[model samples]
Target: MNSPTMHLPHDDHDCGWYGALPSPAPAKRLSGQQQADYAVIGAGFAGLAAARRLAEQKPGARIVLIDAQRVGYGASGRNSGFVIDLPHKMALEHPDPAHKQRLLGLNRAAIDQLQGLVQQHQIDCQWSHAGKYQGAVGPRGLAYLEHFERLMTELGEPFRSVEGDELANVIGTRHYSRAVYTPGCYLMQPAALVRGLADSLPKNVELLEQSPILGLKRDSKGQWLLQGSDGQVRTPSLLLGTSIFTQEFGYLRSRLLPVMTFASWTRPLSQAEMVAIGIQPDWGLTPADHAGTTVRMTQDNRLIIRNTYKHVPRYGKSVNEATREEIRAGHRKALLARYPQLAGVPFTHTWGGVYAISRNFTNFFGELETGVYATACDNGVGAAWGTISGALLADLAVGAESRHLQDIQAVTGMPSRNPPEPLLGLGVRTRIRMAAWNSRSEL
Candidate 1:
């Protein structure tokens, strides 16, 4: 087979999480020739963690972390910033108690590491242990909430059930009929957190933004040769945190499904508007149903509404103006349905992000070939899972062992193969549409 060239991430629209922040310093693009003991691609949570861990483990070695765009301008910065500590409903209800425990352990470990970094570096991303609320609108959503409650009880996890006036008092929204509050999740400004992570890298690690690898091949010495537009990097070991884009690098082509989800953020509300809604302290809520919307009142007093999914197999390169407008319309409708009082409040920014999911909902981690490693297919919880997986990938590469590494390995697996293209696209679209329709009330 011929060497595979990379198809880089295109910035279709501005990410609100990134745009809301002050402009960053000019990006340091790759130039001339470069050599590193280790090269990590994709500057998201996974890549950042992997590169940092490698530098920490091998303090005297050179490590390079490269990104196609500015750090945090891609999916990592575009996510709905929830650092979840517990498994989601599906994993929580797994038949094997040990499997559930391992997942929980991995997630919490990710959070703990991030917390230490935030404090040590004094990164001001508004990191908060604000917990999370799962809200329900109608019967279907309520049923999901009930199931979640049962799982929490079975696991002896502490949670509170709130409804009626209590629910409204908590989130300042009456759209949800009931909610379950779990006090383990943390919320933050994703873009800021990711950028901080990149900036705070150890002295031995070099961060090169806007330096997409245009082509890749193996050299006579069995080292990876990465060709950028303006330069080349030769490294003995290469790590990929590129997520679905890993397919373009000649790996995981048939095992990962790339899906795009959209989000919109409102301009900061005026003090009067805040009073009008009887706003409480900042909070975040996810729908009980998988297809339902995610809502957040940020610490900065802006509202975010994220929902709707599309099977953009082209990895968002084909997302046209029509689809963008349609998603914005959906966001507007959802916002009004929940807060009719805030009608006419305009959305300051709207954008879409792509995430990869495996057929069996497992992550892809470990070595792809000699001197090459990857962690991808995060299945929607990349913030926490991606961080720990990246760190452990470095540990695995260095032949290090620990309880955290073992836990991540136990839960990680090779992504199951997806159906061929046309069939895969059809199946995914059908399932997503049916799910959205079923959860229409929650949306």
Candidate 2:
């Protein structure tokens, strides 16, 4: 019988954040035969955390973490860089106070753990506790923000309301009529952070990049035989943190939805341009309407505009040039609306990143089968959720127990099943279009 093979998508555009960083060291691809006590596929936040935790738990065990591309070249590194401490859009759907509290704790735990790693390794990812701004431009958005404020109050989370001149002074834009500022969110250079974590993994954990798993099978002893392009790994236990691609591994097929989002970054602004804008040096803003644009001013004075979502059931390996131009044009329009003073400025980089979201906004975290564990579909909050889920997954694999693990289970049980193919695509596209129309003013 032919061996079961997996096909992975190839990304077309380079992430602006990754492109801004210095060139990464050459990748160490998997070659020759290898045996590992544990194997992890995907080197994003979740996989990196899983491998690190497993290595910490089993000092003598060999843990191999593999990625199809470089460590900082995937969805984890392509995110908007917000380590959110509180639930945003999810809170609206799941108003259960207990569930929200548990989620908050889990997210905060992720932040604390990340802070320790950054400090210990001195990772220069511009780790900032500078908080986040949720802004609204239209009456619909204002109503949503008001609802969010109520939820925050019910949760006893402190937040400040800013409007008009106050909001403009802070974010350097008067486009938003009202905003809610919460100090719990942390902002950073996502690419830098992921690369730092990969580089500082434990001594026992082996990180293999550019080593896509091409095939899979079981050995005589029922161990996992993972075949790569140049080599293969046989291991007793396997952990999958491949997100939406977990389907390519023959699991989570219709249970996950791959939504592609696009982002564009401007080259670092000249000092004169910076002075002309007269905005805060560094801050991040997410729209009150979930579908609206996300804006950020980097510490280095570059501007980032992120928005647009499309349901790509087949998964987006590479965005075609036409689609790239369309998305960039949308971003350009948003930037001009918000920071018209910088219309002459051009975007240095534009890229698309795909993240998996479930129908019910829950994550898939559990043992898939005997000797195989998996975590996928982080529901758009991948940074914190992915990190925490990865660590907890490692604990489960090692037969260790903790309250955090239980918390993760209590909150995110499993991804609810999704509608099959054509229907799923049609539904998602319709909803996205409706949302875009509603948030047109915000965009």
Candidate 3:
């Protein structure tokens, strides 16, 4: 199942999410052909979550969920594990306000659902609801924080801006001059959660790993066809939860584009180290100003720092050291600039993953050709968005119509330019350059 294209360092994902056990691969190389009532592609969070919900709604639905790689691989396994209610993101095209509000509400609801699932499923993925801090580390960023604080207060949300000692206690950084702490966000171990969810699925729902979906088509009766390797599955309905992998599966490849985000996690820090480094806020998350680094402490005492890599993506799969250094340096600089006290802390692991960003920021959740559907493009914030997106998708598929899904459906139906591969490359480059200047264009 190995490929010449696999990156050596990328294997670090196995250590955290897939656990010590060798997780199942995708559908045994898709041998020959198969049949089902429902075929869900990509066994990560979106697909798995949708499959679980579907089984609950339609008992014995004959669902077959497939993944290109093993379960918990891709962004689900490689993320920084912070479940920020509102993650770092920007929109390519704005959807309706009502839809935006619904998405926001769904996002808030998912935070609670994720916590409940982790517990109900008995997943050992350390979960904490210590809340989150969205603030500024310098005057340049302070204005942004002030705007958020004002907006929250105007909305009648109980948020208070802090400075001086309060700011120091929250972030352990003397560099930050302002802050807005929101109580509700949580931190999670993404990989562990993925495995636990997959392991806890009901017997009726089949989970297949290493099943790279090579093609999507229809049979003589017009049912959905998910073909991969040597196996083919004909299902009455199919959900493409492949997210960033859409580019590899037929028309979907160009239908959605990929955006890369980077993360670095330090080796588990001791209590003393945690306190010394100002990560002592038991269940806290941090989102500094725009173009700023996001930091959060995991249940294991590891400080997980993540940030958007200024786009300007190069073609192909190569990860250049020069670009890596540049991106990593940007992250480290942002971190040190915020927490000057932790400048010397060593990062044991650094990684990146593709975020499937569609032109409209909204993904294709409704029926695509025939029974096939897709739920992806959380922009760059899929942790919470994935849960919300999947739940909404499940509702839509089940005929349980809601304003939330309707809003998103309308947005996707709007005219969209998929931007050919050549244009996508250029747009991303322009994004990165504008990103250097801290414009809102790259969000």
Q: Residues 293-408, candidate 2, lDDT per residue (tens digit)? A: 99988899889999999877655644578888999999999999999998889998988888998887778889988888999988888899889999999999999999999988
**Root-mean-square deviation of every model:** 1.3, 1.6, 4.5
Q: Which candidate is the best by TM-score?
A: 1
C-alpha RMSD between model 3 and the true structure: 4.5
Model 3 agreement with the true structure over 230-330: per-residue lDDT tens digits: 67888888776766554445445455566666776656777786677665644554555556666766666666667765342331254566766676676
For each candidate in the order shown, give its overall lDDT on alpha carbons: 0.89, 0.88, 0.64
- Choose 1 or 2, whichever is better by TM-score: 1
What's the number of clashes in each of the models?
A: 0, 1, 16
What is the descending TM-score order? Answer: 1, 2, 3
Report the C-alpha lDDT of model 1 over 1-443, residue by residue, as the tens digit: 12244456875666889998889999888889899999999999999999999999999999999999999999998888899988876788789888888998898989999999999998888899999999999999999999998899888889999898988876777888899999999999999999999889999999999988887789999889998999999998999999988988888888988888899999998888888897765788999998999999898889999999988777767688898999999999999998898887999999889889888888888999999999999888889988999999999988899999888888888899988878998999999999998889889
lDDT of 1 at 284: 89
Which pairs clash (backbone N, Cα, C closer than 3 Å) in model 1? none
lDDT of 2 at 25: 88
Preferred candidate (lDDT higher): 1 or 3: 1
Reference-based TM-score of each model: 0.98, 0.97, 0.84
Where model 3 places Cα greater than 4 Å from the true spot, the runs are: 1-32, 86-97, 251-255, 281-288, 308-316, 335-344, 402-415, 439-443
Q: Where does the lowest 10-residue lDDT sum fall in candidate 1?
A: 1-10
